[model samples]
Target chain A: MDRRSFLRTSAVVAAGIAAIAAGLAPLRDLKNFESVEEFLQKHYKELTPEEMKQALERISREVERQYGLRPHVRDLKPMDGVEFAYALNLTRCIGCRKCVHACVAENNQSRNPEIQYIRVLKMPNGTLDMEKGDHNYATESVPEKGFFYMPVQCHQCHNPPCVKVCPVEATWQESDGITVIDYDWCIGCRYCEAACPYWARRFNFTEPSIPRDQVNPNMAYLGNRPRHQGVMEKCHFCIQRTREGKYPACLEVCPTGARKFGNVLDPNSEISQILKNKRVFVLKEEVGTLPRFFYYFDV
Target chain B: MIKNYFRFLLRCARIALVGDWRYHLWLGWLAVICLLGLNAWCKQLVHGLIITGMSDQVSWGVYIANFTFLVGVAAAAVMLVIPVYVYKNKELHDLVIFGELLAVSAIIMCLLFVTVDLGRPDRFWHMIPVIGKFNFPGSMLSWDVIVLNGYLILNLHICGYLLYTQYQGRAPSKWFYIPFVFVGIVWAVSIHTVTAFLYVGLGGRPFWNSAIVGPRFLASAFTAGPALIILALQIIRRTTDYHVTDRALLTLRSIVQVSMLVNVFLLLNEVFKEFYTGDLHASSARYLFLGLHGHHALVPWIWTAIAFNLISMTLLLLPLSRSLRWLDLACVLAIVGIWIEKGMGLVVPGFVPTPLGELVEYTPTLNETLICLGIWAFGLMCYTIFLRMSVPILQGKLSKANETPGEINRVCPAIQSRTATST
Candidate 1:
């Protein structure tokens, strides 16, 4: 090659390499690289029982390693002939936010930048309009006169728009009438977040941080396990607890006994009774999500 | 024949590598910006999407907005292709390549914008067609994934075939590319329409739940895309010896003019539907066009875009725009104007009074903005390299007959002289 042309080519090459090197310098910030086992993990449904056991062991180890908490993690299966449903009595709810905090604690949600599954909407007595509902009402009070508390969470809809919009089938409706997300499979496109009318889903924008003592010992594959950054999460109806025949943390914490949960398929279940006899309604029925959650009033 | 094709690719690569100081400087600037963007992206990877202004409420921000606009730009290639290929407009006969090249670059940018927007970009393989789960026929996003990749491949094949044939000094087989061109025209529409469907299919976002979104997307895309081409063609004419006829620019101008009007008309229809009817769902539109409950972050931006569109549309309609200066101004106006209208004006409002009626305004963070700017720079660099390689081949300066690779520097006197003088 000629001297001048050679110089030009070398100069360009040098500049290019230098630029790329400088650009990649920030990669040093990637402290927690994924293990080969984690990276090559199969989709949730595709995993065999042995693989799932290994996965659960890995999660327990990860939780221990990260937070010094050795928790019991399991892949809880839904019971056959059971379609779980929730019923909330509006007249009994006192606008207290214990359910929200209990959920955060039980779900192993991030504490500093708190991730709460339940949002209690303080609504006026006159209208069903959610526009008038105040999510951020700060007062030292319980059921401030003339206002009703309406808690919103994942409806686990029968006709889930969120599931339909998911390009990767990351989030899907489970057999027991609960919507679930496979964090490992989710690409985090946030399309499901946009499709949900209830604003039920939440994305983990950063690495979830929880105090060591605050980490819930009990975990589920699709529920209360500590989530990685950049995945979607929501109320999976306390899957770890519920799949084991225990009530959801939110219902257990409701001081007024307003929250009710049971298998809708069972004729004598509280939820089935609420639906059959009580004056029950679902929020945003016009959107046609056909929610599993029912609201009722006994005033 | 295969050996000759390999030789053609090598020669093209060589041509791209050796350019004047101006080219080097331009490329250097782009590379630096791309690196800076890469740096920012790395930070985002480490920190996660918390670095961006997006939250659970406003899940999509600048990235999705840019992706939407660039899809329109990419689809605008069909605007030029239809006239030259189908209608046989001689003025744009040679110029159609430029539009296709732009489409190629714009689509790459579109894909990049989507990539950077992803929270778990590491799991991108999950969306792949066969190997991955591939939720086809159910998700609009999967459809988008199909149409966009299809359009990109279609454009690349057309451009590659035409250019390779030119380098060999042979007539291109009409059958190989002609059918694809027709398919491309329809494919182009599907790309933008599918992107529109991505927004419109979301019944949760009332601001985007309108029949007019698809037509509006096409209209705005045609306007901004052609407006950008007219400006690009003018720059190419000034810098290079390649002839870009005034008629070509004028034809594109006319397209921009009509589409701009249609774009405005469609926008007006949306406004009337939102404001005149004054439904409860119109809160987002009310927040956008006029401040709602004193939270008016986007009101100024929407107004500026509207003003730019109106002024540019008027100028494009006038005889004064027959002059290049007025035409240039109008094109610039239309490009920037439609960018805002189609981008932030459209995407942001859909999330403004979010599905829950909570007013959470979005403002893109520095890291997000850097990544966006970086993608744009990379796209521009790609277009520049594509032009650098293709122009010599189109002019017959880098044909197979040259045989000896060393003959390139001797034959291309314009480049050598330009480099010599610049140095």
Candidate 2:
């Protein structure tokens, strides 16, 4: 070959090598072959029953390794004839933020960055204007004078904009009314966070910092199961506890019995009774998210 | 024929690789900045987006802002393509390729910005079709992903085929390229429209929900894109032997003047709607313009953008200031003004009052700023390399078959001799 052709061939070969090297550079951070498995894992819905079992077992093992707790991670499918719903009595709620803490403890939320699903807004009496509400109020007492408390969490909407805007369908409303996220499947574009009117979704900006002692051993594949950094997460109505005929931790921890939780499908359920008797309203009804969560006044 | 094509590419690569001291200096500076950015990105990957100035309150920041602005820049290429091909404007026909090149680079930057802004860029394959379920038709973001990628591919094809044919000293087939060029014009509008929809479709963010957002994006894009081209042409004329005619620059100026005027009018219309309506939804606008409840972090920045835009528009409106020096200054102003108008001024305020009505301020961290600068440098490098390669073919220096290897050295002696001296 002439000098020119040789040089041309070498240049082409060099560029090809560089391109391949650049492409494979990101794979170095994948750690080992196990991460390759994690990367190539199918979407939660697309997984076979065998794959699902393996995934749950893998996640359980991962949680045990990371958080020093043998988490009972299971893929909790929706129960037959049970559609979960939540209601909060504004009169009883005193802006104590007890439910927020309870949620963190139950759901294994990151403590350092402080990822709390619930946001308790303190607004003045006779104002439905959410803009007038203060989320960062630091008062010493419970429910300062004329102010009322509204603790906001994922409504698990029937027609969730969050689910609709998820570019990967990583998040979706379950058959049982609880909107769920396949944490492993999310690309973390934060479109769902933007779409949610209530700002109920939280993004894992960093690795979650659950204290070893505080790590909740009970976990759900669709709920809190030791989330990795760079994924979208939010309230899943404590799916780990809820599917097995128990109230969400937030409901259990309420001091004044302000929070009520049950199946809206059953007429005998507490949420149903509240919907029938109380003048209950979902926040941002105009947005038409059709939240399963409702708020009411005892009067 | 294939050997000839390979030879043509090698010649172009040689031209791209070799440059004078000034070019080396500029490239070295860009390389340093890129290295720094890569370092910062590594730290971000390790620590997560927590290193960013963005918070739960402000989920997006400078990276997304830059992405939004660059999408407008990329979309601006159609302005040249439409006038030249449809209206038979010969003055702009020579320069249309430059605009296309700009689109390619801008779209690349847009894609890069989006990639860096992602929380899990490693999981990007999750958005792919079939292998990963893309929520197409349903998600505006999915639509954006499709259009942006499609536009990039379309431009690459058009530019590649045209430039390749030029290098081969043959006429590009109209059947192959013309239909695609028309498709590109429509596709350009779709990219910016879809990007705007990414914001406007969010019913929660009232600031971006305005009907005027899509139009505003188009107006500002048309203004910024051509304004950038005018500046690029001036630099090319000064530094290289490329013959960018004054008439071409003047034509671009006219496009800029009209678009800037429309952009300003749209801004006024948006301002009137927000301030006059006096609703709770206007809270974000109030915070942007007049500041809300004493939190006025973005107030100065928005007003500065408005002032720069108006000043540039006023300059362009006058016939006397249409001289090269004044026109160049106006173009620079228009480019910066639209960048601020669209970038931080537009993206940040949508999340300022946030959906929950909190007033947490967000300023990009040093790491974010460096990364942004690095991306800009990388884009410039790409543009420079593309121009270096194409300009020779356009000049008919490298396309002649009889030209020997020794003749290639004589044709562009500065690069060829520099290579010899360095080695």
Candidate 3:
């Protein structure tokens, strides 16, 4: 080779080496290495049954190690011919916000940054306008004289914009009508967060900080599992509980018994009954999300 | 043949590496900025996006805004390519290469902005088409991934091939690059349109849902991209031995003038619709232009952008201020105005008074700003290196004639004949 070409080759090689060194320098952090297994984990749907069992065990071990609770984290699959749906009674809701805290506690959400899935908006009595609803309403007593309460959470739409916007299929709508995110798989671009009309999704900006004492031992692969930093999380209709034929913690904890959950495929279920009997409406109905979550007032 | 191609690349690399002290100094400064950005990014990686000013309310802040703006810049390269290639405008033929180089750098910056914005950038492999489950065809973002990467590759191929031929002192084979150039012209429109689709397809963000968004993006991109080329070419002429024709600059100026006029007209059309209708959908625009309730943080910014755009348009349209100084100022104004209009005004305001009607103002933190500046510095560095290598080839200073006589005669017969006839 000529001197010019040799010199050029040397310079290019040096620069390439420097760039590779610089790029890989960040990965040298031991903490990054600690999550190597997590990093290589397959997509939730792509996991084999054997791989899934191992994943669940790993998740359980991680939660146990982190929270000092031996959580029974299971990969709950959707049942045949069952589509989940939810309804909330506006007239019965007292703006107590017990459901909000219950969701946080049950979901094993971060305590310090306070990632709560439920938002209870206190609306002025005379208007159905959501814009006028106040989320930070701090009063001595709820059900204040001229006010009504509306608690909004994930609507779990059949045609979910959140599912469609994810560049990676990290988030998707399960066949059971619940939207789920595989925390390990999500790149946390938050496109889904931006796309959700109800602002239902929450991102773990930092490693979620729940007190060891406050951790719920029961967890599910798609629901209340301990999530790492840099992933998206949202309400999955309390998949752990609901999949086991129990109510979501929000419904169980509501003082007014305002929340209802059931399989929509079962015509006799409470959600179907509410849809039939009540003047029900979904939030941002014009957005055409076709939300499984319904809201209604008593006659 | 392969060995010869490799040698050609090495020679090009040699040209890229060899530079004056001033060039080294500029590159050093850029490297320092990039290092600072990398340091800040390391901190962000450790601490997570909580370090950013972004919250769940305004989930996307400055990084996304910059990404959106740079996509426009990258797509704007096609404006030059269209006239030169399609219209057969010889005056702009030499200048189109510079535009393509700018595109390469801008796209690199666009990709960097996106990477830094990702909460789990390490998991980026998940977006790969086959191995990873890329939600393509259905997701606008997936479509974006495809188009942006595709456009980058197309421009790289075109620029690399042309520059290599020029370096060999050979006339480029039309059959090899003509089809790609035509594809690039259409692909340029697609890149920006897909970016616009990324915003407009969101049924949630009312401000971005307008049908006019895609056209508005093109109008602004066409104006801003060419204006940047004009400024860069002027700087190149002043600092280097490169000869950028005045006619080329004038043609670019006319493109900017026409595109800026259309851009402003489209902005007005959007304004009229939003303000006249006075509906709930108009609230985001109201928040942007006039501020909603008591929060008006973005009002002054958007108005200033409007003023800059108007003044720049005026300068470009009038024949009185056609001097170099005035033209440079107009180009600067257009670039900054379009940056703010497309970025802070467009992306942020869409999330302000968010879909749920909560007004949470977003402002980029110092870390965010540094990261942005670092990305810009990186793009500038890439553009500088590209121009440094390509300009010498275009000027015929680093041609095959400089090589051994045997090598030149064997490898570049077309180049020898072209050079011999021209000389």
**Candidate 2 residue lDDT tens string, A2-101:** 8997899799678656744553354456332236668888898899999999888888777777777787878889999999889999999999999999
For B187-298, candidate 1 gives per-residue lDDT tens digits of 9999999999998998778888888999999999999999999998998888778889899999998999999999999998999999998789899889889988889999
Q: What is the C-alpha DockQ of each candidate?
A: 0.83, 0.46, 0.56
Compare the candidates by lDDT and give the number of the best one: 1
* Docking model 1 quality class: high
lDDT of 2 by residue, B250-297 (tens): 988899999999999999999999989888889888988899888998
Please give me the DockQ of candidate 1 compared with the native complex. 0.83
- Candidate 3, residues B1-423, lDDT tens digits: the string is 554576677667767767889988898788878876886787788778998989999999889989998999999999899998879999888889999999999999999999999988888999998889999888899999999999999999999999888877788999989999999989999999999998898998889998999999999999999999999998788778988888889899999999999999999999999999888788889989998889998999999999999999999999944687888889899999999999999988888876777888888889888889889999999999988888888998877768664555555577556556866
Better of 1 and 2 by DockQ: 1
lDDT of 3 by residue, A1-299 (tens): 68998898799679857864674465455263335678889999899999999888888777777777788888888888889999999999999999989999999999979999998888988887667888798998878988889999999998899999999988998889999999989999999998999999999998789999999888888888888888999999999988888899999998889999898899998788889888999988889999999998896
- Order of the predicted models by DockQ, top scorer first: 1, 3, 2
Interface RMSD computed for candidate 2 is what? Answer: 3.7
Stretches of model 3 off by over 4 angstroms after superposition: A1-34, B404-423
Error of 2 at B171 (Å): 1.2
Candidate 1 residue-wise lDDT at B401: 77
Q: What is the model-wide C-alpha lDDT for candidate 1?
A: 0.90
Which candidate leads the pack in DockQ? 1
What's the TM-score of chain B for every model shown? 0.95, 0.94, 0.94
